[model samples]
Target: MTDTFVALSDPTRRLLLDRLSEQGGLTLSELSEDLPMTRQAVAKHLAVLESAELVASERDGRCKRHYLNPMPLAKMAKRWLVRFEDVPLGSLSGFHAAPAIRPAHHP
Candidate 1:
């Protein structure tokens, strides 16, 4: 869980995840293209994501293609968000209690 958070803490890693999400099973070269970082740097970020189990890779002939594994994120979100599900919708909405009334004074 901590690893997942840590991996997501870096913007580069999050971008990589977004790329994978948009188009799964992408090679490192495919991912690195148009990104500010180099191919090696992208690979390093992918490694962290892989360690956190947020991404998975499969051998594609000569290269490995990376894919987003959303299960861990889904599980974490469920754990964190499920507790709030029971709360009243009105509380979450813009339904604040009324303020106390005060008498208007003439200037």
Candidate 2:
């Protein structure tokens, strides 16, 4: 879980995940294109994501293709984020709406 958070902490890793989400099965070279960083830098980011189980890669002949594995993120959301959806924000004191006031008119 910590690994997942750590992997998500970096903007570059998040961008890599977004790219993979948009199009799965992309090679390191394909993922590196259009980015300011070098291929090796992207690979390092991918490595962190892979360690968190957020990215999965498979070798295709001579090249390795990377894909997004959303399970870890889903699991994290289910564990923490889902609970927020169940409880309405209005029910929470901090989120509760203040009473509307009416202006008094002078005769």
Candidate 3:
């Protein structure tokens, strides 16, 4: 979706998504702890990701824990990237396998 691409355009948001993928159900404070920006700034990035359905949150007691929602990204890849999967680009300089971009086997 357009929102997903928009949300992924920012490196910060991508980093946030990466963190969530690495550790799901993290509080905003935990998510922002290692970042150089204030918690509010991180929250703003999270807001955009949430708008794009790239992130989901749930209230747990007094804390709202954030999680990475990969479905939007998988849908996007299925829509756009699947077409290029069989293309041979090995001759291109520096081309290599990117595990991060590869979808996991579901079956």
Candidate 4:
């Protein structure tokens, strides 16, 4: 989705998604802790991610928790890299295994 790519294009937003992937989910305050920005700023970033459908939120008691939605990401990758299925360009598993983009698998 265009929104998904637009949201992931930002480093801060990427960091937010990384945090969610690492921690499963986090509150707005929790997500802001190690970042240089204030919680409000992080919340703004979260808003963008949410709008992009890269993240979703729900209330856990008094706090609002945010979590990553990986499906859209996979869809984007498929749309961008799938090519012609009949052509056999191989799969993402093999593609991501390449040395050039392999480091992306590291934390």
Best by the TM-score measure: 2
Error of 1 at 6 (Å): 0.3
Per-candidate TM vs. native?
0.79, 0.83, 0.81, 0.75
A best-first ranking of the candidates according to their TM-score comes to 2, 3, 1, 4
lDDT of each residue in 2-100, candidate 2, tens digit only: 999999999999999999999999999999999999999999999999999999999999999999999999999999898889687778666867689
Task: Judging by TM-score, tell me the better candidate of 1 and 4.
Answer: 1
The stretch of ten residues in a row with the least summed lDDT in candidate 4 is: 88-97
In model 3, the worst 10-residue window by lDDT is 90-99
lDDT of 4: 0.86
After superposing candidate 3 on the true structure, give the runs of residues whose Cα lies further than 4 Å from its correct spot.
Answer: 89-107
Ranking by lDDT: 2, 1, 3, 4
Q: By the lDDT metric, which is better: model 2 or model 3?
A: 2
Please report, as a residue range, the 10-residue window in candidate 2 with the lowest summed lDDT. Answer: 89-98
What's the lDDT for all of these models? 0.93, 0.94, 0.93, 0.86
